[model samples]
Target: MTDRDADAALDRAADEALALFADDRRSSGDRRESHVRRPQRASDVAETVRWNVADWAAADWGGPVPQDAHAADSVSNGASNSSASDSPADGSSKGSSFNDELFNSDPFSEAASADRPAPDDRSRQPDSSPEPNRPPEPNQTTEPDQPADVPNEAPEARAHATPWRAARTAAARAAQPLPSVVRPLGEALGQTLAEPLAALTDLPSFDTSAMDGWAVAGPGPWRLPSKDATPEGTGTSTRTSTGTGTGILAGHAEAAPLSDGDAVRIATGARVPPGATAVLRSEHGKVRGEGRELYASRHITQGQDIRPRGQECRRGDALLPAGALVTPVVLGLAAAAGYDELTVTSRPRVEVLVLGDELLRAGLPHDGRIRDALGPLLGPWLRALGADVVATRHVGDDPEALHTAVSASTADVVVTTGGTAAGPVDHVHPTLRRLGAEQLVDGVQVRPGHPMLLARLAPGRYLVGLPGNPLAAVSGLLTLAEPLLRTLSARPAPPPYRARLTEAVQGHPVDTRLIPVVYQHGDRACPLRFHGPAMLRGIAAADALAVVPPGGADQGAEAEILDLPWTADGIGISADTATGTITGTGGTP
Candidate 1:
């Protein structure tokens, strides 16, 4: 190794040693072994790769070792793949192009080929890998923090990424819903009902007046009963009167039974008196002089203006089935059914790790750092998709820190933004390998978000890695996170819908394209500008995503639509009906 390479490697070791000493999580006795975790296979390590930091630094260690690509090529890559001395971190040849990545091949390796040349015989795959041997177009822009040369993933993973539909399915099937929880009504909003919503009591348990009116036995125009008469029942429905009735009030005890041909004044929601066969609405009835008698201004039918017992739901009846979404309306229904709390499927608790050393939390992009867009976008977006975001921590790009954060997480799902691509600082794949997590969806056959992935961290826990770009991350959110959260929350899948295209759209030769679109005249879907993976303008103003099939779609063709949640803070897509082009009001974000 060169002097510089030696110094860097030694520095890394010193840092690790310091961290081990400072670590409060581990026991002191556990540090008895040599900290240098080397590979078992002879070919896996070079003479230079092995270090003699005391006799305990043995050669046959069987564990993951995070290594730098330039330090020594003989050092094994984290995955099941070999490394080339001058090879790109990813196994793809230097000649691999971006077009081929989007078309005709699996694409888990997010190599930044466009930003820099692959080592003479190397490759790292990702969103910006340029077409081989071609100059970057004048309008082409590189993603932030993409250096001219960086170590990436092996080409092997890229060659076997899952397709879009299958990736979504695999994510949905990765884990089951968390255990049920009994949350109070205040906390159950947006949760899924774990059990059927059976009524604790009959809705409208007694025959009650539906309006301010008179409860009359037989027909009105009959003698008016004295208001002070005891509320004694003459029929099966009589309720005991609580006090002298000004009339029957809503919360008061039941009034005296009505004598045949007699009427008593009653308020809306008051229990109907016994012997009262029907209710005459106040406006429809009149009191004669001296108020001794009542007359029906309109025909009074039996049971009119009265809410019969159990009008809405009877006791023990299921008002809502299990898996029902608990919306505000549902909360009201539950309250009316006498539920102080509800049995709901526990929301999937998620911890978000925002990776990358070039991210700024609160400032203008400067000093080689860019503002973190995904950090703000994901929390609320995930909430809308039915997840409880427990924490959103900035984990940076250190492999060890990423590992520590991931391993220590108690959340049901750990979501990571950026570092998914096979770049030098891309520690997500390596960290996941260290944790023994299963990659359910390595990559996808979709544009802008092809590098997104889903993995199972443990039996009931999962992780979803999103691309670094803003728009690409959004695609992953809907494609992977949304489905996973929905399934884990026991929420029903939204019905798929399609819309006619207002204009023609180009499609990827093989991969599917998710384009932002807005509803147009005649319910057609209009594609928006600035729909690139890194751009967020189009999505901010979009009503839904138009799933354009491979090879493109013609104007007026029907395309599947994935609707976005409505937001008052969103911008609109204004269509130029004359030209068939769309301009979004959402400014660059």
Candidate 2:
């Protein structure tokens, strides 16, 4: 059936189910408006029921859904208590409510079971093709223990939010670009250009020699002035009796005009003298008779070894447009094009607040206190991610101190590590509540870092709360902080890339999984060990995070990869592909 037809069918089915429920409710004297006043728990259950009905309706028509949706259906369908109303007045209603029946009695199942196709009916069946934009139904199994139609429990059911979706939402909300600023070319590295880099004047500005050669007016057998020669009929050596002005060095100006058949010694990058037809290599042109005569052994072309004006670019040419990333090479080009400074999108100034009193600043972990890993890691990582981290302060779990620090800070982004959860010392949420901060992302479905969050502290300022675990914090950084920073800095998103998984990666039943992976030969991504949310070993050695979809990916399956900022920009990590270990000046990531 076409998608339109299926949608129509589902709509009709929904109307019929609602009508049946209306009749049942009327018979039981249950007011529909009572649902609105139900307790929060009951309201949640009712919503789940509605979702389950929608699932069965979709399933009856054979539409596939994402695992998260499917798991919700399973939870709803397993509810044996089929009561539309749980009021004290209606103490018992043994029969299934219309709502419950919709979830339990799938219409397609009944139709298929009650009317097995007759031999004659089967012969007359028409050929069918899948409707456009309609996903083919997954093959269902009928295992007695766990029916094929029943979906597995979703991993997301236990988590607070989905990682990628939350990140995208945060980026969309903070879509405004930061203020622009003019910075010296050297300081503009890693910034996004706010204006096009146009050449001030034509490159070269004049015809110049491409190499150290003789500037010739015409074909060789050209004669040089006897003053440029020695008296003994031998060519002038490096030590010439002639003045320095006689031979052209690079940056030579006020050069004597060349006449027809005249040759002058020239150096690389020296402007060709006016009236010169071409340049001949010093070795190619034989200087004889005390340099009085120069003979070209090989024929010379008009433009050979000469760089004409505007060879690289014409005057006022746009070398790079706005929104381009200012790399070292771009800075060099801007400098060469006569640009002393560049107008670039300003970096969001970020202040990192490392929470948790349990975190130790130095020395190995003694007692229960572990060394503060994020304090050292976040500042540099934030810089690489295009934020200027103003300060990284260790704000212990004191609520008053955290509040004071946050209220006083003026940075565009406030990154708080740990204390996102509602534990005894978790003051981030309370502080944000006290400050009236707007929550953007409260938590994520990602493993090892489900407690990560994003909040808007003030206009043009945000707070990204990362879980205390090291690896989980890393996940939150990439998932939330990176996208937000990129948007604020007006940097374009990097194009998506995918690679085959060299090994199997266990997937979250519903949510997406981001696993630390090193890219291998043959464009394959190898999942690293020690990938627990608390462990940093895998991410430290990883090249990128392979985004495995809801269902686990088998070996050789294609997986989308999220490249770490350092991987693409060559920040701290120097990746040795052969050894599959990344090294940096200060060590690994």
Candidate 3:
């Protein structure tokens, strides 16, 4: 069924539920005003229910939720000015209150069931072809949808937060590779190849001995080059006085040419002389007449134990394709292929603006101030992600300072920590508006970091606003910044990795949740505890962030794995006992 059909159905169900709530109150009421807050539409009914579910379950109209980075704007928008009467004369006549009704029966159960289709229902399939201006359903899985379905650089698409996959796709498509640069091999690590790494010359470059014994020409029973005089039926001359030594060694001058029936000792990696056929290993050859003659203890054949020139690759052969990440092994290969300087995609320069006033730079939290974890956390983390973190400065909550910091940033990507929400002190949105930045992604439909946003400062330059909370900021890093930077650096996107969950993970009702998980028992991803948006304990020890879909994941359900930058080296930070600093990563995160 279509998204609108489902929403309309849910709206109808919500309307009915609201009507039931009113009717039940009236039938038993002795003319008491019903004071429960309600939603303006059915789509909001579920969110409203979620907002109050905790309060009603506790049988109390709790105080207002704190306005913070974690609290969604949608949740705080539905404020209530009225509540039920504290005392009623006819207690029995008042009947079950709304709380009791909610506890006894689910308010949105029918709507949820109607919205979700049966497992075997053919109509459950998502519409592959959506009309123009259509937004994807929350549960719909996308696969490189058309430009119309997924807006890359358009502002009209900002009406709704792009789906997680679509957001990544758009981010990657939004920027191009910065530019190619020729850097020495020493500085090329962690960069991407801007052009095909073709072999400058033949690998090995020359035929070399692959063994430590005789470099024999024309087969076995060859006479050896020795210092002793030639005995009867034996042979050769000393290689010492005439040359440097007997055997040819690696990184030395070329050996004299060998004629048929003559042999010379050679070391592994030593260049084989012209007319040499095969090399007999030291262990496989027998020395006769006190080393005057050489004989193969085992049969020797032509071209044995020899590395031919260009054995691995020929001149001008592509060693690695363009856009390949230059790793340590790649460095070795390039060096082997005769490359001293490489043309690689330059690392995208990132300037991190940490925004907060209450955050303490050092010392224990005192007088309502906490340590600044993100400042220490983001720099090296971004560096590990292949970004050249040029600078990380603490930009206070002052709007003017933030604008100045952002406007003056010459870095390719400007990452700001905190102040993305509509809180009284949140100034990110206002600054962006003042700067006329085109917001590509205002917010994501993901938990913990939904307030994160992406805006284009100019062509090929962008800004990513991250939440202040450590974990939420990490989520923003992975969600928006990662794809953008990866694309800008011309790094190939990692293959989609998935793992089956070892246990169930409760999910957000509407938004996607990134659960920090560790791999156990092979490929099973086990969820860790203390995964709240504000807490960094779980993610500090996580192997990857699992992309748990809406409505949660069941046991053994496969979820996409977003790898951590430090996952390869097992990046982990030991949280301080007092939550002040994580004793690793050279930072407090």
Q: Which candidate, 2 or 3, would have the higher lDDT against the true structure?
A: 3
Rank the models by lDDT, top first: 3, 1, 2
Error (Å) of candidate 3 at residue 339 is 1.4
Stretches of candidate 3 off by over 4 Å are: 1-159, 228-245, 568-589
State which candidate has the highest TM-score. 3
lDDT of 3 at 76: 40
Per-residue lDDT over 1-589 for candidate 3, one digit per residue giving the tens place of the 0 to 100 score: 8756776676565545444434543353112112233333344555433333322211111111222211222334454312212223111125765433221211122332344333223223344453556654543323221111111122432347667777777788889889999999988888899999999999889999888877899966887765543322212322542231267777765567789998887779988887799998888877777566777888877799999999999999988999988888889999998889999998898888888777778889987678989978887787777888777777666888888888988999999888876666789888999999998988777766777889999887899999877788898999999899989998888889899998665554446778778888879988765565667877777789899886567778999999998775321132222322222211232
* Residue 356 displacement in candidate 3 (angstroms): 0.6
Per-residue alpha-carbon lDDT of candidate 2 for residues 71-133, written as tens digits (9 for 90 to 100): 333444564333322322122246746433222211223322244232123223232442345
Better of 1 and 3 by lDDT: 3
lDDT of 1 by residue, 1-589 (tens): 8645554565455445434322421232121112232322233233214221111111111011222322332332334333433455333577976532222111112231233222221112332433465543332223311111112444554466678878878878877888999999988888899999999998988999999877889965777644444445322232223221346778777677778898877778888988898988777877775565788888878888889999898999989999998888899999999999999999888888888777777769987678889877777777777777777778766888889889998989988988787777888898899999998888887776777889899999999999887888898987899889989999888788789987666554446778888787857888765566677876777788888775567778899998884431121122213312111111122
Which candidate comes out best when scored by lDDT?
Answer: 3
Off by over 4 Å in 1: 1-154, 226-245, 566-589
TM-score of each: 0.68, 0.68, 0.70
- Weakest 10 consecutive residues, lDDT, candidate 2? 31-40
Report lDDT per candidate.
0.66, 0.65, 0.68
